[model samples]
Each structure stands twice: as C-alpha cells, then as structure tokens.
Target chain A: MDNSVLLKVNQLKKTFIKKSGTVFNRKKTEVYAVNNVNFEIKKGEILGIIGESGCGKTTTARMVMRLMEESSGEILFEGNNLCTIKNAETNRLRKNMQMIFQDPYDTLNPGMRIVDILMEPLNAHEKNLPSNEKLKRVIEAIESIELKPAEDYLYRYPHQLSGGQRQRIAIARAVILKPSFIAADEPTSMLDVSVRAGILNLLLDLRKKMGLTMLFITHDLSTASYMCDRIAVMYQGRIVEIGPTKKIIQSPSHPYTIALVSVVKDLNYFIENREKLILDGEVDSTRKDTGCTFVTRCPHQEKVCHSKAPEIEALGNGHAVACHCHSNWLEKTS
Target chain B: MSTVLSIENLSTFFKTDKGIVRAVEDVTFSLEEGEMLGLIGESGCGKTTVAQSILRLIEYPGKVVSGKVILNGKDLLKATDDELYSLRWKEISVIPQSAMNALNPVYTVGDQIIEAILLHEKVSKSEAVKRTKTLLELVGIDGERQKSFPHEFSGGMKQRVAIAMALACNPKLVISDESTTGLDVLTQAQVIALIKNLQKKMNLSVILISHDLPMVTAICEKIAIMYAGKLVEWATTEEILNNPKHPYSKALLNATPNLSDPDREVVSIPGSVPNLVNIPKCCRFHTRCPYAFDRCLNESPELREVTPGHYTACFLEGDKNG
Candidate 1:
C-alpha cells in the first residue's frame, strides 16, 4: 500500500512434484522450494536477498521475474499484480523487469557479438524503434556500463572479452531495455577478486544513473551488506529476517541471520581476534516439513522451536525476525 | 621458529609452441613449523603453480628450472623418485582445488581414503579402514557415510572427505590449492575452521593458496601476494591487510569488497593480468600500475625487505624509506 514500494511480493509459494516408486505404482512427493514469502522493494532501492544455495533465494527471484510460474501469490510490480497478467501482457511487462543471471559465460550467447546481445532485449521489447535508433540505443547502453571506447567492444565476441568485460556486457544487455526494475543474482560471484569491485561499483552507479530498482540476490553477506539498502535473510524456502543492512549486520534478530553475519571473515584485525560462533552441522535441504528450518543447527533452540513455527515479530525500525528465542536472546545479550 | 618449507628463487616454466610460459618466476618464501601461509593472487598469477611445484606435481613440458624446495632438511627436487614417492603423503600432501571433482566418484569415500593410507604405510586393509573412519570423524563428516559414493554427499561433505584423504598419511605439510573456492560462505567458514583446528591440533604447516583475501586472512598467519609469476609482497596477514606496501598488494586490498566500510570508495585495478608468454621485460604490473614511472620500465625491482618482517618489490619504497 505504500507509495514508495516499487515491487511487493505477497505470500509467494512454489512447489515441485517429483514422481517416485516403480512403473507399476506411481507416487508423488512435493518439494516445497519456496513457501509463503513476503517482501517489498522501494522505488529506486536495492533490496538484497541473502541465503545459502537451495535456500530459495534464486527461486524467489525467478518467481518475481516471472521466469518461472509460481504456485500461488501476488507479485505486484508498480501497482500491477504481475501474476494476473496474460501471456501477451507479460511480454510487455518484461520490458520494465529484467534479470541478470549468476554465470556470465552461460548467460550470453557465445556466437553473438556484444552489440547483438544488447540488441536482443531492445528488439524484443522495443520492436517499434527504427534501425538507426536501435543502433544508437545499443551504443548508449554499452557506454552506460562504463565500457569506454564502446565501438571496440560493440563488434567483439564474448570470448574476446575478459570475465569482467563479459559481465559488463550482460549488464549492458539487461539495462538496454531501460527496465525500471532488475534482479541481479550473484552477478560478481564468477568474477576474479580484482575485477569484482569494478562490477559492484558499476551496478551502484547504474542504479543511480538509470533510477532503477534492484533485487540483488547473493549468498555473501558482506557483499549484500555493501550494496543493499535493505536485506531479507532466507533459509530453506522462507524469509527468517528482513531489515536494514546495518541492523542485520550489527544487531541481527534471527538466530540464523546472526550465525550468517558472524561467519563472515572480517578484514579488520580486532574483529578477527574475537571468538567466532561456529554453527555446527550442515544445512539439510531434504528435511521435510520441519517446524523451523534453522532449529536443527540453532544454538539457542528450545523445545517449542522443534514443534511450533515462530511468526515474524516486529523488532522496530522496519525490522522483523522469526525466532522463538529472540526475546531470551535479547535479554541474555543485553 | 624452525622453518618447515623454504622456497628459494623458485622458477617453474611451461614450454609451449607460442613461447616459454614463465609460470612461477623467482618466487621465494619460507613457512615456519605449524604456521599457515596464505598465497593470494588472481588466476594467472602462478599461485597454484608454486603449490604444484612444491609437491612436484608439474608434469609434461612444465618444469621447475631452478631453485631449491627444502622441506625440513632435505631438498625435495634432488630426492630420488622412490624417496620422493615415500616422502609424499607421509611428510607432505596436497588438498587440491575443486577437491569435489578431484575425488574418485567411482570409489566409495572410505575406500579412497583407505587406499591412500595403505599406499603410503605398510598397514593392513582393516587398519587403514579404521584410520579412514577416524580421519572422516576428525573433519566432521559422519563415519558411517564412508560407504556412500562421492555423488551421495553434498559439495561441502565431498570437500571434507578430500581433506580427510589429504590427512590419511599423517602428513606434516598440507598444500591446499583453492580448497574453498566454490563453497558457500557458511561452508567455507566451516571448512576453514576445520583446517585451523586440525592445524593447531596436529601442529601442521599449511600452504593455503586462494584468491579470496578474506578467507585467507581468517586462517593464514603469513600472506604472499603474487603477480605474473613474481612474488610481489610477503608479510604477516595483519601487515598485508592493514599496511600493504606494494602497489599490487594495495590495489588488491582496495578491490576487495569490505562490508564493514560501506562508505569507502571501490577502485578496481585497470587492465587484465599480463600474457604469460609475452610478459613485460621489467615490471609485469608496470602496464597497469598507476604509480609506474620510467625507472619501472627499464629495470625489474628485487623482492627487498622494506621492514623487519614485511617485504615488497617496489622502487617507490626507496624514495619514501631512503
């Protein structure tokens, strides 16, 4: 309902049915990849979704992008529920929303030139534009990504470019449509460490220059904290915590979020000297219908956490946490 | 203060049709007993090549042309093939990068570890199996799952198994080449913790080769920054992270995304790493370095000790410290 909200996801759910048993007797098991997720991205804001692999962060982003059909829920994009849109309408809506995938190597067509990659989005979305206008737009897009001497890169193939250059091309393709909202899923994870900062800075710069709203999904908390204004911590198909980046890092409310933050290797020596709270045990993705996904590894889990799921409780400053022992944790820490 | 491994002016080159690819050039560093040294560099910077050369894993046209790899007291290069084979896994072993794929998928996790132990030591099959279970438990994997295939376990679990296999022969030195590259943050932290714990418990010396600076800082006591096969800088992790002196080292630290300092500006080092075959005659980094001057173009800087503990190869330090 807020005017500032650019995109709102309401109770989104997705499930995959897998066939089991022999050919004679078929049985099915539902894999709930994402379930009952809710969040919102403000206009021109970078909302980060942080989670481990198979935690439904990618699934959530895909569902919002409408790349995959959701089982149930509303994906409201600028007052329009994207889920209600028809096939023809969805094509038009895609112009305003785009996604940049994790692997740059797989995302771009190997045989295609950098110009063609950027032009594909424009040709599909802006079919009405003239040939000369399209060429101009393509050049503009290349320059927008700060790939100077755009002419040199325009005709070059993906292989001719470096990892950082290819990613910049991918970004150029995503923004060539002039999308108001974009979902970038681990864009810099595949890049070398020396080139990662350039990509991150380019994204931040592009966000301001284009006035774009972004949903940045990454498993690295440090990267999320650096780029995002707000973050939602997801675990096993559910969002366990949602708050401002500073709050999530400094005063994480959810036990899982706290564990995630604590595990990040800090660059500062003083912080490195402090004791680390090691979260023993691995993340079990196959566990079925558990009360709380994090209860298995939670340090302060109570008996109630094993049987009853905790509701998201308001923790002030637009922050929320879902944990049964949050109050007890607060008291103990204070 | 005893040195566990000392590499002196080590240079490894790969002969290709195009030219001689200088993979590791004049790289020198020493690792103390029970110390964890982090070798941080980009993909083509020859960090892994240095690690491989230590274990004599470089095959075919690639050769370690010069320098001595002195482990404990013996020169590893001069040791006989039979002696080298015996010394490997017994005294020094490696946990390679992408250990998940490095593991034998056909063999069960338990069998592979047991095979490693049996090959190194004149132990019975049953005794080797027992040691495998203990090693698995040590790395925090379920000993019962040893019967399962590599595919049956997750990525993190597979890496743990690899670590177990590396430690099967009770080797004193473990060279881990990008051990935690593909793992998620939590798993990476867990693996690093496991390595640190094991290092302290066994008094093991580790050569952790990775491009991930943060991960390196977490586990390593000393850090080495390499660029185009050259040792650009070497110092304590604290010194390297907090007071990087070399231009390449400073640029690398600046490029890393620091979450704690969100307001700081991010500046990337321009241009890619030099082509190995046509590497610059002087400073390889002179092409991309912002501080490069005419003097840097004519002569290569030697790896000099700028301070008591820290060493950097940069002509600019001479003006400031002189």
Candidate 2:
C-alpha cells in the first residue's frame, strides 16, 4: 500500500447480461463492460480515461465511483478495500468520493432550487449542523463555483439556468462535500465549445484549490490532452495504453491509441497532408475471452493477437502498452 | 473564382411573445465556386438561422426581414415559394445537424435518396436508384446496405447516408449544419474527410455550420465567427488561426483545445450568451470583453477589413487598416 496513493483499482471487472430476440426465441449473452482494469491515482493528480462511445470508459468510471457494483475486483481507497466494507461504512466513505455526470440537465433535479440542490449533500452528511451554518456552507459552495452574487441563483430552478450554469451548480453540489476524489464522466460533452472551456477551467481551478484527484472521462483526445496529467486509452472494456499525456499523444504505442491520436482534427497538420490515418469498423464490445479485445479492428493485428491476449508491457517512465505487435508496428512506422 | 452565392445584409428575426428576437442581424458574406466556408458559433449565436434564411427555411413567426440571397445570378429571397422549392435541391441542399433524429426511421435509406433524386431531376425510378448507389459509394458506404432502415445503421453510417441524400440531386452548394456534432472522433474524422474529398471531386461549394472549431478549421478554407447574431470575424483559415484580430475570435481560439499548442491554458470568456430578444444597442460581446472600454460600451463596431483577406469587428484594432 503506497501512502501517497489516494485510490487503487485492481483487476476491476464488470459483466452485463444482455438479452435479445423474441420470447419464443430468447437468447442471452454475457457482456464484459469493464474487464480486468487496473489503475492508481495519487493525491492531486488528474487521470483521464478516454475512448470512443461504448468503449467501457464510462463503465470503468461508474465502477470506481461505486455507482455500479463491480462483478469481481478490489477498489482500494486509502488502504481499505471499498467492496468489502459494510453498508454504513460505505455511506460514510462516499463523503470523500463524488461524481459528476455527462448531462447536467438530467443530473440536477429540475424541481429543486439551486440552493436546495447544493445543500442536499451537507444535510445528509453533516446532519448536526445548525440551519444558519448550513446556509452559510451553501453560499460558500455557490460562490466557489463563481456564480456571482450567490443570492441571485440560489432560488432559481435548473431550467432557468443555462447548460453551463447548471453544470456549475452540479459541480458545486459535488464539491460541496469537499470530496478528495471526483469522477467526472463526459462532463463537457453536452456543452457548447465556448461554454465547455469554462467548466474545464473550473474543474482545474477547483483541483488546484482543494487538492482533488480527478478521474476525467471524455471521448475527445484534444480535451484529454489539455486537461489530463496522464491518460489511459480504453478499447472494448480494456485499457490498451496508459502513460503520461504527452507520451500517449506524441508517441502512441497501441494501434487504437495511434488511430485516435491521428484522428484529432489538427488544422495545420491536416492542410499539409490530407491523408487520413483511419481504422475501419466500430468497436466490438462482445469479447471472445481468448484473444485480444482490440483484434477485431486493430490495424496491426497478427496471428498471435488472435490466439492470446497480450499483457501490459512496461516501457519505462510509467508508460505501458498492451499489444503484441507494438514493437513490430513501431519498427515499421519509424 | 466566380461567386456561387452572395448574401448581403441578411437579417432574420422571430416575433416571439417576449419580444422580437433578432436571430440573425446584418450578416453578409459570399461563397466562391467550389469553395468551403465554415460558419462557426456557439449555440443560440444565430448561425443556424442564417442558414435557414438563405434557404427560406424559416416559417411563420420567424421571418427573413431583409436580405439579398443571390444564387446563380438570382436573388432567392425574391423568388416565390414554388421557385424556392425548385431551387432547394437543384442548387442548394443541407445535411442537417443531428443524424440521430433527423432521419426518418420508417423509410429505407435507399428509397429516401431515390425519392430526392426523382423529385428534382427528370429521371426514372431505376435511374434514380443507380444515381443513389453512386452517391452512397461516394460517401464510402456500401450500396448494397442502402435498403436498411435508419435504425439498423450506426451513428456514423447514418451521417454518411445523410451526406448521400444531400448529394442526391448534385446541388452546386451544400450546407452541412453541425453534421458531426455527436459522433465519435473516428466517425467525425471519416465524415470530415469524406466531405473534403467530395468537395474536390465535385468542385462543390460548401457552408459547414458547426460549433466544433477544430473540425471546421481543418477543412474549410474560410471561417466566419458569429456571436449574438453578428459576424464578428471572417478570414482565411490560416489568418484566422494565426492572427485573429477580434477579441471574441481570439478568446474562442484560445478556449479551444489545440493539439499543436498543448501547453496553453484555455481561458473561458466570462458570462453566458446574451438573451437574443433584447440584445444591447452597443456591441453584443461588450459585456464579456476583457479589454472593453467606454467607447465599446456605447457604440457597435462594424466588420472592417484589417488585412488582405481578413476582416474583424472590434474597436480595439482601431482604424489603422480600415
């Protein structure tokens, strides 16, 4: 147990039972949404989990937040296995862990006022606080999110506020508890680009001010490059590559990571060479159990990739890639 | 290069109960033949309304109050409903914003495109189907699966289908409004590349309306930044990226996450978009402008040429090159 580590996720796995076909011809299959995932976050670090849609990034985030139970794994928080904890203990532990969802409109209650929304966590966790003190805490939370003259927005409903404002209120609600760890799942995906920067800046500011460790999940590589200290690229319920953000962006080792980095719309680069480094086919999440999960669409897949899954091989300085053909592909490209 | 479309002082407003919402105000720009222009703006910034105004797509309470939308030497605004109807698919077509809900799920993808072809061109059913297959192939979709319903296809495939449908009648100009809004990175890249390749092969004029700045700048030769129903800046892609004169354009480019400038901190413009119904008499962005002075608060700036092939609407740049 590393004392500096805030949260450790070891061999996290989740299986979903998906049913299809009519009642007369029913069929069921097991889908591994998060399979054998492992990662660690130190205090005050921002670890980004990025992937295409249905690539298990959100699933991994959910399992870490304990919003969804893992099928079998260990989520060690501060040297305690969260899964083995009792219900009452887990509720207390949740005070240090918070999550912000993708859609701010859906996450915040439309009927409640912004003040009430921000105060729910305080009321639940700090029940013994006096009314005046609670209201003071509420105002502090609202002010922390930079909604000027906190009184102006305290009584307004979610519908009355814009998308960015609602997201701020949601962040206020999450950080109202002063959580040490936060899992933000596509927090800015629904926002307009201009408004999205505000939320990202707010998150970064709060992380600096409060010493919060963030698991920022997004589908945009450019954003991940901007906000993350390190990035873990997920594909079909598995992290194919994990490394420092610059390393992943500059020298992506995995085939999927390379494809993702190449697809980023860079104006200067695209004009000089309009050639697309594209990979065909959508991500197939139904794992066959024996082969590499990315083999279905991997551009550099070979005979070895079809029979055995490649283990994560370290390449020094906290960069690792899980692919058998990485060395061969690197040799060819270089 | 000859001009394919010219818009002069285009102003579209909605007479809502709250008041008259000036959605698109005094907007003017021109598109060259076989050129690609990107109209980039935030939501409610009136980029979509401008596109609607060009095609007379606004209805009832919302109307294009005054403008000259000249298409192939004819002012589209002056044309009758019948004339506009005929001109829509024949001269200009649109790939609408959302691929998820824009498509009709009941109709087969092939039939919809074929219907589009049959409506405009004097072609037989078999001939329309043949052309539809070619359009499908042009967008990189397999022509055989054109018979599948919209629900059966993935998000990217549906977007390709939309592109195919937009090109059914070989319209000289295509207006793709946020076509890649909700797609994944790879899908968005594929769609953008497809549009670029199609533009080259067909020599078609394109007006790409989107909030994705990087995607727009990557493909479009010219970029227009819209804020609160006004064209704040317009320039060649290179000039716009390198030397953005308008404060709003500069802030937008700064706010955007660029791969090349990885270490830059994205500074968000303070304040939300102003209410369109009661836009201030002065500059619309004056409230959020960090460098705003008393003059900016009292007067609005006009879009003036700052350099060759670059224009900006800002008081800070002064009248040096105007």
Candidate 3:
C-alpha cells in the first residue's frame, strides 16, 4: 500500500507434497518450502534474503519472479496483487520483473550468441520494435554491462565468454529490458572472489544507474551485508531477523543471525573476545515443525521456542526479529 | 618444522585440440609439517591442476611435463606406478572438490572410508570399521550415520564424510582441494574450522586449494597465490595480508569484500583470466595486473625470494615493496 514500496510480499507460502515409504506403507507429507514469508522492497532499495541451503531463500525469490507459483498469500507489485491478476496481465508484469540465477554456465544457452541472448527478452516483451532498433538496443545493453565495444561480445557464444563475462551477459539480459526490479539469487556464488567482486560492484553500479530495486538472495552473510541495504535472515522458510545490514552483522538479535554473521570469515581484524556461536548441523526445511523453524539449531533456544512460534517484534529503526530468546541478546547488545 | 612436501619447478600441460594448454607452469611451493598452505586462484588458473599434478592424478590429455613432487625426500613424479599407488592414501590423500561425486553411490559411507583405510593399511575389516567410526566422529558426524549411504546425508554431511574418508589412512599430508565448496557459508566455515583443527591435532600438512581468498587467509598459515597457471606469490598469511608483492596478490586482496572493513572499496581486477592455450611465456597476470609493464608482457618473471620467506613472480616487485 505504501507509494515508495516497489514490491510487497504478504504471507507468501510455497509447499511441496513429498511422499515417503514403500508401496505397502505409503505416506504423503507437505513440505513447507516458503511458509508465511513477508517482506517489502522499497523503490531503489535492495533487500537481501540471507539463508543457508534448503532455507527457502531461492523458493521465495522464484515466487516473486513469478517463475514458481506460490501455494498461498499475496505478491503485491506496485499496488497490484500479482496472485489475483489474470494470466493476460501477468505477461505484462513479466516486463518489469527479471531474475538472475545462481549458475552462469547453465543460465545462458550455450548455443546462442550473446546478441541473441540479449534479444530473446526483447522479442518476447517488445515485439513491435523494428529489427535493427532491437539490434541497436542489444548492443547498448551489452555496452551498459561494461562489455566494451559490444561488438566483441555480441557475436560470441556463451561458451566463448568467461564465467564472469557470462554472468555480466546474464546481468545484461536481466537489465536489457530495464526492469524496475531484479531478483538476483546468488549470482556471484559460482564465481571466483576476484570476479565475484566485479559482479557485486556491477550490480551496485546498475542499481544506481537504473534506479533498480533488488531482492538479493545469498547464503553468504558477508556478501549479503555488502549488497543489501536491509538484511533478512531466513531459516526453514521463515525470516528469523530483518534489520539494517550493520545492525544484523554487528548486533544480531537472533541466534541464527549471530551464527551466520560469526561464520563469515574475513581478512578484517577479528573482534576481540566476541561470543561466536558455532552451531552444529543445518536448518532442515522438511521434517514438519509447528514452533520456530530455527528451534532445532538455535544455540540460545528456550522451552517456548520449541512449542510456540515467535511473532515478528519490531526493535525500532525498521529492525525486527522473530525469536523467543531475543531479549537475551538485546540485554547484552544494549 | 620440517618441510613435509616440496614441489620443485612443476609444470603440467594439457594437449588440447587448440594447442598445448599450460595448465600449471613452473609452480613451486613447500608445505612444512603441520603447515596449512592455501593454494588460491581463479577457475582455470590451474589451482586444481597443481593439486592433481601433485598426486599424479593427471589423466591422458593432461600430463605433468616436468616437476618434482618431493614427499618425504622421494620424488612422487619419478615414482613407479606401484610405488605411487602404494604411497597414495597411505601417505598422501586428496579430499576432492565435490563430495557428491566423490563417493560411490553403491557403497555405504562407512564402507567407502573403511575400504580406503583397509586398502592402504594392513588392517582387518573389523579394525577398519572401528577406525572408520572414529574418523567419522572426528569430523563431527555421528559414527552410526556412517552406515547411511551418500544420498542419505545432506550436502554438508556428505562433505564431512569426504573429509573423514580423506583422513582414514592418516595421511601425513592431505590435499583438501576446495572441500568447503558447494556447502553453505556456515557449513563451509565449520568444515574449514574442522580441517584447521585436524591439521593442528594430527600435525598434518594440508594444501587447501580454493578460490575463496578471505577464507583461505583466515585459516591457512601460508598462501600460494596462482594466476593463469603460474604461482605468482607465496608468503606467510600476515605478509600476504599486510604486504603482498605481486600485483595479482594485491588485486585479489582488494577485490575480496572484507566483512570487518565494510566501507573499504572493493575494486575488481580488470579483464578476465588469460587463456592458456598456445600462450607465450610471459607474466600470466599481465592482462589483469594494473601495474603491468613492458617486461611483464615480454618475459615471464621467475619466483624470487624478495624477503626471508616471501616469494613473488612479478616485474613490479620493487614498486610493491616501496
């Protein structure tokens, strides 16, 4: 409902029906991939969804991109409820939203040239544009992604380009339409640190130039902290903590957030005598749980955390956390 | 500490359809007893190739042209097939990059690790099984879970199994080539911490080949920075952190986003990693090196000891030191 909000997700849930046991003994179970996930990305703002594998970060992102249909709940983009919208209007919505996937090697068609890869979106969305005009725009898009001259890369196949180059072309493909929003799901995770930095900086630069709002999803906290204006830590399809990037990293409230932040190895000088919670095991999304999703792995879990789900409580300055034992951290943090 | 393993003038080339691909050329580094050496480079920079060349794992198309992989004063490269076979797993074993593909699907995780131990050492099935349980427990996995198949374990658990398998024979030297890769960040850190802890506990020499510079620098005592098939810099972690000699090393450090220093500018190195196919002898990093000079383009820089222990292969070492 907010004028500044570019995209808002309300209780967006996605579940997969998983069946276990043999022919004689069979049982079907509903795996909550994305359960009651809610967040909003303001115009020109980047909100990162940080979580480990199987934490539903990618699933939530796919629902926003409309690549995957949500089981229930609303995806509101610019005052429009995308879920309720007809199929005809959804096609038009595709023009404004695009997603950059994890693997660059698989995203692009190896057989297709860079020119054609950039043109496919345009062909689908803007069919009225003349052939030459489309070609010029493809070149412009290539140049915009900083693959200089554009001609050098336009004719080359995806196989010919390096991983970073392919990812840039992927970014080029995403932004060629000049979409208002981009859901980048671990775009640089596959890249080397050197090239990873280039991709991250390029995304940051593009955000400024294009005035783009991004729902950046990553498992790496350092990367999330760098790319996101606000960070949302996800565990088992639920947001454990959502706050300013600095607040999440420096003074994290949730135990999972603390663990995530502490685990990110950096060249920067280590914080002296910091309480590093090296929690064993990972957050499994499937087994079915009624309480807080992170209860299984939370180092500071209480009796209430196992029986009752904690509601998202505002901690001021747009920061919020869903943890029964958040007060323990708050006391220390204060 | 004594030098556990030393690679002298190692060169591995792949006879590709295009030409002779210089995958790892003149890469030299020594790992001391209980020392953790981080072999870092971009993809195709031949970090993995160097690891492969060490264990004589280079297959048909790729050949270790010339190198001396001296382990325990014996050149592994010159070792006969029988000798090399005997040495592998018993003295030195590799923890491959992908744990998913590393384990045999048909075998139980315990059976796989037990097989490795029994094959290397003169141990009975019962003895091997007991050791396997201990190994599994050592890597922070429950011993009972060893009976589970690879598919039964999660991505992180499978990787831990791989680590347990790698350590089964109690190899004096372990080559954990990107072991933490494909796992989540928290798991990656935990696995890395496990490796570091194991190295100290067992007094094992480790060669951790990866592309993650920050993670490498954080745990690895020494670092060998590679680029386009050449070892650009080899130094202590502190030296690499505070005073990196090679332009590639400095660029890598700069390019990495430091979590502690959030406001620090993350400047990416220009240009992609150079193609090694039919490449001439020159600084492999010249194309991406900002301080590249005429000499960098014309000739290859040999690894020189600029300081007591720090080594670098760059024309602009003087500039770096100054």
TM-scores of the models, in the order given: 0.96, 0.96, 0.95
> Candidate 1: global Cα-lDDT?
0.87
Residues B220-302, model 2: lDDT tens digits? 89999999999999899999988899989999988898876789888788887888896666788988988888888888788
Model 2: how far residue B261 lies from native, Å: 2.1
Each model's Cα RMSD: 2.2, 1.9, 2.5
Provide DockQ values for all models, in the order shown: 0.58, 0.59, 0.54
Give candidate 2 regions above 4 Å deviation.
A265-276
Give me the displacement of residue A173 in model 1, in angstroms: 1.1
**Model 3, residue A94: displacement in angstroms?**
2.1
* Full candidate order by TM-score, most accurate first: 2, 1, 3
Colliding residue pairs in candidate 2: none
Candidate 2 structure quality by residue, lDDT tens digits, A1-334: 9889999999999999888899999888889898899999999999999988888899888877777899999999988898888878888988999999999989999889988898899999999999899999899999999998999998999999999999999999999999999999999999987788999999999999999999999999899999999999988888899999999999989987877776673543533333434455766566577889887666677899999988888998999999998899789878
Model 3, position A50: C-alpha lDDT score: 88
Q: For each candidate, give the interface RMSD after superposing the true interface residues on Cα.
A: 3.4, 2.6, 3.6
- What candidate 3 gets wrong by more than 4 Å, as runs, is A265-278, A329-334, B318-322
- TM-score on 0 to 1 scale for chain A of candidate 1: 0.94
Full candidate order by lDDT, most accurate first: 2, 1, 3
Q: Cα deviation of B38 in candidate 3 (Å)?
A: 0.6
Candidate 1 lDDT for residue A223: 82
